[model samples]
Target chain A: MTTAGSPLVGSSGRGRVGRRRARNRERLVSAAAELMAEAGVEGVTVSAITERADLGAGTFYNYFQSRDGIVDAVVAGAVETLGQRLDALTQGMADAAEIYSSSLRHLMRTAVTDPLWGRLVVRLGIAHDQLIATLGPRARRDLLIGVDSGRFQVPDVDIATAITFGALLSAIHAHLGSDQASDPSGVFAESLLRMVGIPAEEATEITQRPLPPLPSLEEARVILGGDAEG
Target chain B: MTTAGSPLVGSSGRGRVGRRRARNRERLVSAAAELMAEAGVEGVTVSAITERADLGAGTFYNYFQSRDGIVDAVVAGAVETLGQRLDALTQGMADAAEIYSSSLRHLMRTAVTDPLWGRLVVRLGIAHDQLIATLGPRARRDLLIGVDSGRFQVPDVDIATAITFGALLSAIHAHLGSDQASDPSGVFAESLLRMVGIPAEEATEITQRPLPPLPSLEEARVILGGDAEG
Candidate 1:
């Protein structure tokens, strides 16, 4: 589906080139994700990415114009389906508090169980453009819902959103740094719910409520209609 | 007094030499502080520091063994007086909530009014060892008081401390990034106070209360018995 002769589209003009281009892009994105998860955004290099993918250095340029292009692709590829999954999980939930709590809980839980996702996020910190682009508006949307429903007493939704984003990154960084055994997703969400004006007891209850299973990546992609070829 | 013939202590062996060494060390620390406050922790280098201090490159090694040494000195020199000043400001306050709010307010207010201090802190973030070493304990100490006095209902002091540290940095980053005219320190502290179980009304009241002046660095030094030369 990419334009002809685009570096990311590869130089091969054969009938199967489109399929090959897509697969190559996927490989490049995953390689960048792994490196980001391991050493952070600043640690990534085009050479390192190509090396990790076991592709020729020149093959990298055939697929990406720069390191930033690959980084964006990695974030978009990872977050698009997950964002859809979160929306699906929170659908039809009337309680805005529960909706917010559920979304945050899922993120925290995934960070714990999914090393690649966790490290990528931790390395990115709170200032990565792609992360904010993908999740910032989603968080604000849920927070606004709570405010509109009178379920939360936030002073300013924008400030609250910033706090929530920072708090999540910090909490995850702390959780991963320590040897603490218990899953902190519940506690982390509880703390933020309270910050947004939910009472302690209610916030605790909402966070501890059984979380539904996250849709698998393949399922999420299908649900999101992300398979361009099929 | 530093041991004789130490690289960190300088090789000069005379009465005036010790005084000169102390003066040069102070100069280097301030130079580093200025650079860090301008360009962040990562931006300062030994060459830049010496250049800013107007000292020879080799002179930097006379007092500091490495760049890390100067960085620590800068943080210590800056934070020590500020920490003591905060202690003086909050002394004899009976209400733990007020004490906590006051401390946080002072920190936030400083960040807004003092551009140098603000930039330095925003650059440091939460994980900088020097920052955590200075502000981390003070925050925890005040938080523990609130918890002990039944004024706060924190689930975990350590986690709360981590959250507060991260939230402050993030909030400041957000605030500075925007052109909002109003000071956010009060609202920021109020939100945290509420998170720790203070009722919204009470948190607002506590945060909005009159803030006392921070003791000057000199006065704080006197209070701390920090006159090493004497």
Candidate 2:
């Protein structure tokens, strides 16, 4: 019952109620993400997400509108979150090569650090329209930036974007398959930089350069605002 | 049907019977390949294969052991055939860069010339075991050859193999998605060559070199022996 005096719906306890709601929503999203990674997009359903989150089925409606709603939440929290961070990280960087390399290195490192997130993106496959829609523009933007600056000798920005998208997912799969590998992110970034026409020596050096950290989720929520409300 | 003089079961018509069986098996495999390309590995079925081939239900058992048997036949006809041809084409090549570029160019061209095959491979995704098993080792071998010959500057071969496997499929998906792009094969192969550490100028020249034609299916059957027997 959403009574006027009930704490959840009551204005008197609004701050605590909002925190609890957000926490439940985050739990639901994380649960859906885990299931999607283990299986694929088809594996996620409302019952599955709610059960995984250990929340009552009735509570699901309080946050998400449907199975697909939670799915988008998961994407926003994973792919979009990272994309926003990459955007923020590269915003002021002058070297387009470094900008591209940093974004990719962070992506490769995700498989090592946040494996569930990594596996989820890899599971979506390249053809998943939402996945393509989210990452494609960011990839194109980065490549085009490099092309505009004459830092990259790309044959076609579209082809290079496709190459980056494909290479990133496959490389993540390979990294997850093998537990022990030496500095995969560096190797991956170096190879991609070279593909975009950076000299081998310079690509190596740029990938070796220290990468700035992604902003914390709190900062991202503030920066990204509506894009990551879930 | 089992009468002593029935042509299909009679000894005197053995040659024609064998030819008919081979043709039927080819038809079944082709049907399965087309379905697999349009849907995915899980999309194939005995009935579906027979239905697509316009053959009677009874005829399916005469050719394949099971649904999986025909799927294997499809892989044998597609991925393995291409792998064998690449092996043949690169047998005496002195430049590892050209060998790599030529093999990639042909793979890219498959998307343009025979799109169904390309779609099937891309649909299989990077995590597909059979696709990886068939293509991964060849990619690793090519990279290692380049590395050992001092012709490439790969940071690590395993990462590069993953990149190639991922890049090839993703690039094919990209090429198939866009119908009017100019010489995607050359663009893809050229970028890959650069990724493996060839300089921009030389990578362009290598990709532009005249690529040898893949051996005919009959010749591939002779050369690859059991690998191409679908």
Candidate 3:
């Protein structure tokens, strides 16, 4: 309802419109995120998102060009933000192998505690470029650090990164599906650490070390710099 | 159409009806598999299956009770059949590590040679239980063999199995996504062998050894001894 130059509409009207637009976009993103958690990335459609948001089909187009647009927005907001937070969370660590092990342990722990988050990422599968783009480089960076310091034996960094990413999803999926009483974070991280050429015993020891907590969203925002919004 | 107690319909009618049912079901499986490969497991639906099968919506129910039913049939058919064939192909191998490596290499090579097969399994994602059920036990069995032989250092068999399954999908996803001219089979197997506790140089050598051909369908049937239908 705001016009650039109108006799009747004033600056306050533009401010109200801007706030409404932001709120509506947030609604769409939330709806998409929830739907993706329930029904993988491919399951999220524009009509479904608009319906979930209680907005008109036309409103969806105004906010997002397509399903992919909204998916990227969701992944960027959630997964990428978490990636940055994990990055910020581990920056003070000195050990290359611990950095990698700690990051993986935290990822599995997060998935175990938050089933919705785990399902969304697991459902995104391997072809999900946004998910990979967020997590891949960070994983690669951690592995390279391990390799450079001679703390881990990573013969192929790209292959190792791909395995780490995939194994995380699979382990989360396995834990979610199974009813066995097991500490997944420790074992999963241990397996991956070994995969990267850490001996089994040392990998186990590294993963067993007290895990530092992830920063709260507010703390992560301040620590990572700038608005966390993608 | 034939009725169980219809004298006039006879055995020929029953035979014709059975053949027709088999043909219709095959159409549905092929349709569902194609849709799954294109749209992922969550994307395949009853209407989509029927439409792609060139059958009426009601006809879909005549064969499969729901989308899950048809999806299971598709996964069991394509994926499980491959698993059995893999079993038949490697039954006589002396080295447990070679058995494991050869199987993984074949899987990667199949995916590389056949993109559709690769996409269908990857799109199935991590949560598809039937996919896991078919592949999990075999991976576990291979790991157990390695463990029992004292050739591989597997601290936890279950976790290693999960990693192997996840890494296969992830590596295939990586190879399909990238244009990298890397031998995914050797590198992937090498990484996994290292992960399971083989030393780097030795793991590299094992993966580099000769790989025998997988059994053809006819050969697999004779070798496996039974109808391969799940």
Model 2, A33-97: lDDT tens digits are 88999988776788888898899988999887888877776776677657776777787789899
Task: Give the docking tier of candidate 1.
Answer: acceptable
Task: After superposing candidate 1 on the true structure, give the runs of residues whose Cα lies further than 4 Å from its correct spot.
Answer: A1-24, A78-81, A216-230, B1-27, B34-39, B51-57, B221-230
The Cα local distance difference test for each model comes to: 0.75, 0.79, 0.80
TM-score of chain A of 2: 0.87
- lDDT per residue for candidate 3 within B1-230, as digits (tens), equals 01001211113445767867777887888888889889887778888988998999899988877888878877776777678778988888888889999999988887887777788889887677888898999999999998999998876788788889999999888888889466688889999998888888888999999888888555776787776632
Candidate 2's C-alpha runs over 4 A off are A1-25, A45-47, A55-69, A221-230, B1-24, B45-47, B55-69, B221-230
Q: Tell me the lDDT of model 3 at B98.
A: 92
Candidate No. with top TM-score: 2
Model 1 chain B: which ten-residue window has the lowest total lDDT? B1-10
Q: How large is the i-RMS for each model, in angstroms?
A: 1.5, 1.0, 1.3
| Alpha carbon lDDT at A151, candidate 3 | 87
Q: Candidate 1 lDDT, tens digit per residue, A1-230?
A: 01111223333465676777677776777788889878766679999988987888899999788988887777765665567678767766899988899888888777777756766776676656677677878899999999999989998777788788777777777777777577788888888899888889988888888887876544554565644211
Query: Which candidate leads the pack in DockQ?
Result: 2
Q: Model 2, range B1-230, lDDT digits (tens) per residue?
A: 01001111212445776867766777777788889889887767789989998999989998778987777767766787678777877766898998899889988887778778788888878987778998999989998999999998998788889989888898888878876446699988888898988888888888888888887555655666666443
Give residue A164's lDDT in candidate 2 (0 to 100).
Answer: 94
